[model samples]
Target: MSPPRRSELEMRKELVRLRMEMQRQQLDYHAEPLRHPLRQLGHLFAPGRAARGKGTPLAFGGVLLLTLFGKRLGRFGKLARFALEVYPLVSAGLRQYRESRPPKPPQAPPKPQA
Candidate 1:
C-alpha cells in the first residue's frame, strides 16, 4: 500500500520545525566563542561568516556599524538627511550660476605665418 500524503498543515508544521532547527544551529555556531576563552579573540581577529549575508564585507560592516552606533550617532543621521534634501537645490543653484557666467573672450588667433 502507498503511504498517505501529508496534509498542507502537516507540511507547514514540518517546515516550521526545520526552520527552528536551522535557527538553533546558527545561534549555536555564533555563540561558540563563549565556550572557549581564547575563541573570542579569534572571533575578533577573524570574524566568522555565519552571520554574514551574501553582501560584500564592506556593506556588511557598514550595516553592522550603523546598527551598533546608530543611536549614539543619531545626530549624524539627521545631518545626512538634511544634506540629502539640500543637495539638489545646491547643485541646481551652482549649475545656474555656471550657466549664467559670461564666456571668457576668445584669444585672438595667432598671427598668420609670414
Candidate 2:
C-alpha cells in the first residue's frame, strides 16, 4: 500500500491516545479497593514513623498481638498488660537518663584550611 495520508495518521494517533486513557482509567478503577489498605500498610511501615523512639515498635506489636490473640494469650495476657502499663515509666526513665548525660563537644571541621 502507498504511504498513509496525514488525516489517517492523525486518526490513528488519536485512537491510540484514547485507548491509553481508557486503560489508565481502568487501572485506577481496579486499584481503588486496595488504595486504603495499602495506604494504612504504608503508614504502619513508613520510615522514621515505625520506630520513632524506643518501645514504639514494641508497643505497637504488643497491641497488635493483644488484638489478634487476646483469647489465646491466656496467662501471657496479664504479662503483656503489665508490660504495657510499665512502658511509659521505662520510657520516662530512659528519657531522664539521656537528659542527665553530658553533651558531646562539637567536632572541628574536617576540611583543611586554605
Per-candidate TM-score against the hidden true structure = 0.34, 0.39
- For model 2 the TM-score comes to 0.39
Counted clashes in each candidate structure: 0, 0
Q: Quantify all predictions' global Cα lDDT against the true fold.
A: 0.61, 0.72
- Candidate 1 residue pairs in backbone clash: none
Model 1, 1-114: lDDT tens digits are 999999999999999999999999998874564466465434434534333322345544544454445446778955654654455466667778888999899999899888
Judged by whole-model lDDT over C-alpha atoms, candidate 1 comes out at 0.61
Instruction: Report the CA-based lDDT of candidate 2 relative to the real structure.
Output: 0.72
Worst 10 residues of 1 by lDDT: 47-56
6-45: candidate 2 lDDT, tens digit per residue: 7988999999999999999998975654565556345555
CA lDDT, candidate 1, residue 44: 35
